[model samples]
Target: MESAARNISFKEKANKALGIVPEDAIISKSYLFVSFIALLVGGVLGLLQGLNRAGLLELPLWFNYYQVLTAHGILLILVFTAFFTIGYFYAVLSHTLDGLLPKVRKMAWIGFGLKIFGFVLAVIPIIMNEASVMFTFYPPLAAHPVFYIGLVFIVVGVWMCAFGSFIQVANWRKRNKGEHVPILSYFATGVFVLLFFGSVPVAIEVFMIIPWALGWVETINVMLSRTLFWAFGHTLVNIWYLTAISAWYVVVPKVIGGRRFSDTLTRLVIIMLVVLNIPGGFHHQIVDPGITESVKFLHVFMSLAIGFPSLMTAYAMFSVFEKTAKKKGGKGVFAWFKKLPWGDVRFLAPMIAMIAFIPGGAGGIAQSTNQLNQVAHNTMWVVGHFHLTLGTTAVLTFFGISYWLVPFISKRVLTPAINKLGVIQTIFWTVGMIFMAGAMHWVGLLGSPRRTSYTTYSDHATALGWDPYLFFLAIGGTLLMIGIIIQVYAVIHLMFFAPKGETEFPIAEVEENATKTPYWTERWGVIIVIMLLVIAMGYVIPLVEMIVNAPPGSPPYSPW
Candidate 1:
């Protein structure tokens, strides 16, 4: 038995030394390839929408503005982020946990197929201009029944991948009993847990909508649907965030020649985020009328509670930076920042992402306030907020990950030229987002509305005032298009044409003499139960009110 154990241990070490197993690499590569494809297509759609909104481009009636808008939101916010998160985490699981089990691998491929098939089904309607209800797809603004059906498949696909991660992690723990899961893998576990639970509300929402959309039900509860959608919507936003920060904690440290922050602190942040995340959705509905003022206030507190974990993250990251710089013999407070790598694309991109979030997070808190939300709700300000958070913070981090992750999975090296191109791409993206998002916020404060096509309102003075800012939006979109082209080229070259060599999956280690993390942190089952309880506490009352004391339902409307 001891010899058997020894041999197993040897095999696991060999697997690590040899890098990602070939079979597992294919799964990550496939997901990544599809994700970047979505980015390319979605990025194009984004530029078109930007131009149209700026009154610079007039789309043909065959493919109108709303269709483009809906598709853009779905492709980037839903498809691009979802695919990249799954792909990245799968690679993390394989690298840190030795390798994926065969069944889990099979499930991943199955999930990929389902998602692709579903995306195709959903896109057909968008192309036909039958599903212009936007990504939110809330009731009364119904899409084709097929669109909701497609969403069901996408949700199931996500669940499959989530469950596969669970199986992979559970198997690893059983094999290495009493040992803490590697930090990167631990982050992956939290991400997949959020993916599974976060998507549940959306799934339920979609199922309810399909019948109303098909006319089996004459009318639908609009507020209830919006409530359900936000439950998933807000969580989905954080799922991308958690994916971004997993790298912030694990990969960024190694790229910068630093050790990770305290292991116990890191795990605590993850637990706090998972437990407190779902309830924060209520803030999205603060402006909507169905829920009571006291309920919204309670939810405002819940939303603020989520920010605590983000603050913890901010603290942990800077500490790593200062400590690492001091070890390298840096002087003074701010001088340590200069000692850090500013040229490496892997570092440069995520660093900018973190910087963008300072304002992005602040904007989110402002929007959660009752009075402040009433000001920005359904305005260009809201659009600018997400653009900053998701477009800059989350998307740029994904770009940073791709520089290393693409080469690592492809068994190739990131060439100096490609890295240079990535740096330029990051610069373009940052400047573009700043101009566009900044203009959006300014115009929104000037009372500009969102979700409308270009209009001068018969050249009214207030409407004319927005044109200057809208022109800035066009300029930013043009720059971002250039960024996308360069980024896509870099990804393709790295995947297929870059010189063959080994690339290590860069996961940072804890500092020497670090304290051991408690085993209780590994009790995800209990953590999940607590998360569910908190979710129930947050949603039960409001959801009950929305349903039981409900207003008259509205029938489907197809304004388009």
Candidate 2:
């Protein structure tokens, strides 16, 4: 078998120097630009929210902060993360295959352009205060028809990227004949499949509810809409994290100079992710009024089931790290920890992310418990939990992957000084989130709400306790924003100003003794279908009940 790296030659260097960027580089740059812009927009919104909560910002009582919050959450969580995940998958494929897909490449660029244009159109009426409907697009509270129409275009654009990826993987398999798909590629393909089906609800909601809200349809059921929305929303975060995990699987082994502890186990873990991701969406509905107690309990149990794969991952990766560290002349259980390259940003960022996962997993377990769910639902505690998991753990993994890939993609060496700054930035982000989450959790125990724009003093003691917690959260938010800015600066510098170089890192190789498996089992289509069935079993019953007994004038559940 020929190595893919053999295809690249010195001649390609001249092409790159002539300002003709490589396909992977272009994709990476595009996603980076989008993510940077998203960070700015989301940050401004966050700052405003914090200020409003603290009574530092005053506006008309009629002004809807809910709309602003919804936009910020959707842009950061849905749009930006999706763009990054797609771009990262493309980068990995280009690197591993040592080639580009021309049709896919063109499609991706066009999709990105259209999505950006759609976002601009959607935001216009929002900024003008003419569209104050919250992000969920629940019926009866209408925005401009353009907002919903534009959202549909954005979703269509994302689908185009997903389809392009599916085609590229299919082509790769056909061309390679008997070669086994690399485990990382296999995992990425699985995630794309999940993204494909998981987004259907949001697409439908945008098409149906937006028009309905705009009076195109006579009436829509609000409850049914939220149910469907969560069906999609629940799995969306999992999809994003799955991509992050794929990056971690590829990069962690390289950073630690260790083969995966068990190749079979790693594959099993991925299987579990596909199986467990969507069923757990029910866990999100625990606090809803109409849902039955039995169904919520079933989801709570399934949520616990999702933890199995996480534990498996932790065991496999840590064992590999332990073995590698000992082989390199370190000794003892904890001593190997000391030998790790703490100064290397690539190593540190992921290490911190993994550490944050300890808290994330613990919080998840808390939320999954029926009794605990009652205590935490709709409280600042929920806010703290997600930020720890998604913001600290998942976002940091993205940053680490970008650090490793930027130089390879850009054909330039990022400044070591800037890279060091990035490491510090990640530290601040992790620490700040920890403090903020802790404070929020404490306050939530006293019944502080999650979605409120401000906290009012109904009693002196409650007000005093809430005020201090809000103050701490404000400080944490400021620190996180600063860290985010530094990261943006580092990414921009790597793209436009980093010194060009000819050095090539070898295509990462899996050790010969690494795990091997049958081709049929690895096919992503089979895995994804099984996953969908599991999700359906959990969701189908509730959906039926929602349809049969939905209250009049209430929105139908729309899980996107």
Report the number of the highest-lDDT candidate: 1
> Cα lDDT of all candidates, in order?
0.92, 0.73
- Tell me the tens digit of each residue's lDDT in model 2 across 516-544: 66666656667777887887888787878
Per-residue alpha-carbon lDDT of candidate 1 for residues 227-328, written as tens digits (9 for 90 to 100): 889989999989989999999998999999999999999999889989999888889898888888998888888999999999999999989988988888
TM-score for predicted model 2 compared with the true structure: 0.91
Models 1 onward score TM values of 0.97, 0.91
Query: What residue runs in model 1 are displaced by over 4 Å at the alpha carbon?
Result: 1-17
